[model samples]
Structure formats: C-alpha cells, structure tokens
Target: MYKLQVVKELHSSEGKMILDVDISVQQGSFTSIVGKSGAGKTTILRMLAGLVKPDKGSIHSGEDIWFDSNTRKNKVPQERSIGFVFQDFALFPNMSVLENLKCVQSEKDEEQIKELLSLTGLTALSGFRPDALSGGQKQRLALARALVRKPKLLILDEPFSAIDQETRIRLQQEILKIHKAYNLTTILVSHDLTEVLRLSDYVIEIGNGKIVRQGNTDLFFSNEGKTDQFRMTGQVVDLICENEKCFAYVVVGTMLIKARVEDSMNTALGIGDLVVLSLNDFNPIIKKIKP
Candidate 1:
C-alpha cells in the first residue's frame, strides 16, 4: 500500500495557507483527488513527484520512503520511478514520437520504447511528429513516454481536460487498460466527479486545502457529500425519459441542466414551466458540458 502524510504551507499575498493532508492507497488501486480550483490538488501531486518541497511531512510507498521532511531526506525526481502525464500533453516539438520515448531512456533500454509504442497503439505513428498527430494520438504519445520506463507510480493531472468528447472517452478506456495491465498504483487529479466515479477505487475530496471526504466511490453515490450543490433554482423546459425515468431540463439564466426528476417532485412540470428541476445527487461527467 502507498501512504501519504503531509502538512505544507503556501505563502501568498492573500495570506498564509496550510494544506494538511493524510491519505492511503492500496497497491494496484486507482485513487483520485477531486476538488475545486486552487484547492491544493496539483500541489499534492507535485509534492509526490518531488517537484515541490513541502514545508513538513513524509511520503511512503509500501515499505519504501520517498520523502521525510523531518529527516531532510528527499529523493530526486528521476530516481523516484514515477510516471507523470500533465494536462498540456507536453510532447517534444523537436522529436519524433518514437524519439521522444527514447530520450527518457538509456541506449541499453531502447527496446522498451517499442513495447510502449505497441501498448499505446502508436507503433504505426512512430515516425510522426507531435504536431502531425491528432489530439488523442498526441495524448497517447505523452502517456507512452511516461510508461517507457515502467514507473511504479503513475500520476495524471486533469488528463481529460484538453481533449474533445470522443477522444476523451477513447483515452479513458485506454488509460484503464494500461493501469490494469501494469497494476500501477495510479493517482488521478481531476475536478470532474464523473471521471472520479468511473475511474477511481477511492476518492479524496479536498475543500479549502483540507480533505473533507474520503471513501469508496459507491458510498459517495449512495450519500452525496454536498446535497446543496445539486439543487439549482430554474425553470423546467423539457422532460426527457429513458428507461421509464424522467430527466427534466432546467434553464437558469443562460445555463441549462438535464436534471433527473424524482417521483416526489411536487411541481407538475411541462414545456416552459417556470419551476425548479433539482439536479440529482450525481450527474454524469462528460469531457465537455453537453446540452
């Protein structure tokens, strides 16, 4: 199991901020960090990658120790054996797809690049440059480069944020495939609740630099963490039915939401009814906001 116990502070013009966090992940489990912007999600991941030094805390992966602020022991980023895929798809503009993979590895381990290419279905596009590939293909190359060394831990930060809807779905499936194949201890940083629900075995909900909730995804669906966030005062414009359940369209200002209408909904809603259609505790997370 991988465990993280950390307390860090950030100094800014706004004021001093403390990020007190504690979490654990079982081996081969997919864990997600979910929170609003500036909630310290990226900071935690950067700390694990050894890119950012924490004010105080320790990080342990099973029996191995990665960082101990008390002892002043910190591993170099390259020595940590961590695979990171940032949201920007940071592929090298100067290198071909295959060459990018080769740069991260030694000449003695050149054959591993071929394995990565095939795994991500990029073997045929090995000769292509970053600019020549599609968004999904470029994302795959970025991931392939990360896995070329077969790192023990994989961390992705808002990976789906840049891709189109169709590409995002395809990439999500590919990610699940790779994670299971390697049995990697994966950590995902994302704000999309649906992605967290679908991809993660455990979720850590951060609010104002602290963990507000932590548990299995199923438990979250049964009892939502914040019910008030689901309700929006709007007008019911349309009723959509699938599998005999109704999904009502609620229009608030310029925004529209497809809310699941429960049997107990008091207002009799029809087209253009000025009534609030409360959103369900959970809404399907798509890469893009759909109408």
Candidate 2:
C-alpha cells in the first residue's frame, strides 16, 4: 500500500501556494489526479517522487519512508523506485530509442527493455532516434523506458496530451494492459475526464491546492439521474448553424462559450442573453470556451 500525508509549498513569479494533501492507495490500484492547470497536480507528483520538499506532514509508501517533516528524513529521486512518463517524453537526443531504454540499468536490463519495447509497439523502431519518430512514437518510447527499471509505482503526467485522438485511445488501452500485467501502483494526472473515468479505480479532484472530492470512478461519473445544481456564469451571443443541429454562442463578458443545441431552447435565446451555464453538478468540458 502507499500512503501520503504532506503539506507542500511552491514559489513562482505568479505567486506562492501551499498544497495540503492526504491520501492512500492499496497495491495494484490506479489512482488519478484531476484539476485545472496550476492546481498543484504536478507539485503533488514531484513531492511523491522526492523531487520537492513538503513544508509539513509525511509520506509513507508501503515499507519505505519517503518523507517526514518532523524527522527531516527525505529521500532523493534516484533512491526511490518510481517509473515516470513525462508529457514531453523526455528521450535522449544523443541516443537511439533502444539505447535510451537501457540507460537506467546494467547488464540485467536487456530482457526488461526488450519486453517493454514489444509491449509498447516500439520493437520495430528500436534503431530509430528520438527525432526520427513521430510524436506518438516518442510517447511510446518514453513509456517503455520508464517501465524498464521495474519501478513499484508508475507516474504519468498528462501522458496523452500530444497524441492524436486515435493514438490516444490505443495508448490508453495499452497502459491498462501493462498495469494489469505488472500489478503496478499507478498515479496519473490528466485533464481528460473520459480517460480518467475509464482507467482509474479511484479519483481525486483537486482545486486550490486541496482535495475537494475523492471517490470511486463509477460513483463519480454516474448518470442514472440528473440534477441542475451546476451553474457556470455566461451569456448567449451567437447561433452557429449546422447541418442537423446548431451550437449556441454564449458570451460571458469578454469570453465566448459554445454549447450544443438540443431544441428551440437556443432559438429562444437571442444574441447578448445573460445566462449562467451550470456544470457544478458534473465535471464536463467547456467545448468552445476561451480561457
């Protein structure tokens, strides 16, 4: 099992914020972290990976002591057995795909490296360098390299951000297969709600550097019934004509919002109609909203 109890402080030109988070996960479970950008998702992962310090609290992963504020015991990233797949797929420019996979281990790493390459569909591209591969291929190579060391915990930071829609779906399935095969303790940070619901056994929703809600994926995405409790501020601006349907253009002050039209309800709304679009009840994407 993995346990976390930490208070982290981050400083940047934008501002400073404290992240007080506490959570636990059992072995062979997939946990997902979801939040807007700059909500401390990456900070939480960095702290878990021992790349950042926490102002208070402690972190315990099974039998190991990762961090403790009072005792002042902190381990380095190399000391922890963590497999990390970055958004950029940080492959080495000087090495080929196969060579990058072998960098973390000695003579004992070849078998694992070969297995990862096969699993990630990178075996045929073993000789290719980082620049020669496409964006999706590079992402796969990063995943393969991360798993070659046989880490107990796998951390993925928006692993599908740069891939196309088709490749993204394929990679999601591949990750699920890998997780089940190794029985890995996986922690994923993602903005895609569908992917989170599909892969995670447990979901943690963060807002303002704190966990706002945490629960099982089914309970979180349940649509058996509906409610109108979620209301986001906006205004109707334009009517985008489509073939069989239409989209509403809602102007929330300087920003414009686009929502699918169901019926004459949008027809009733003319340009410059003040409205509050509700999304507090469920977590859904703002399809055409300008951030």
Model number with the top TM-score: 1
lDDT of each: 0.77, 0.78
**lDDT tens digits by residue: candidate 2, 1-291:** 888898877665569877888888778899999888888998888888988888889888888999888999999987788999989888898899988988866357567887888898889999989999998899888888888878889999999998987688778889989999998999999987667755798988888789978888666545223434455565454567788767765534223345666565645655444455656346322332332
lDDT of 2 at 249: 57
By how many angstroms RMSD does model 2 differ from the true structure?
A: 8.7
Q: Backbone collision count in every prediction?
A: 0, 6
Q: Give candidate 2's total backbone clashes.
A: 6
Q: Whose lDDT is greatest here?
A: 2
Mark the regions of model 2 whose C-alpha exceeds 4 Å error after superposition: 12-14, 223-291
lDDT of 1 by residue, 20-115 (tens): 898888888999998878788999999999999888889887788889988898988897889999999988999999889988874447577777
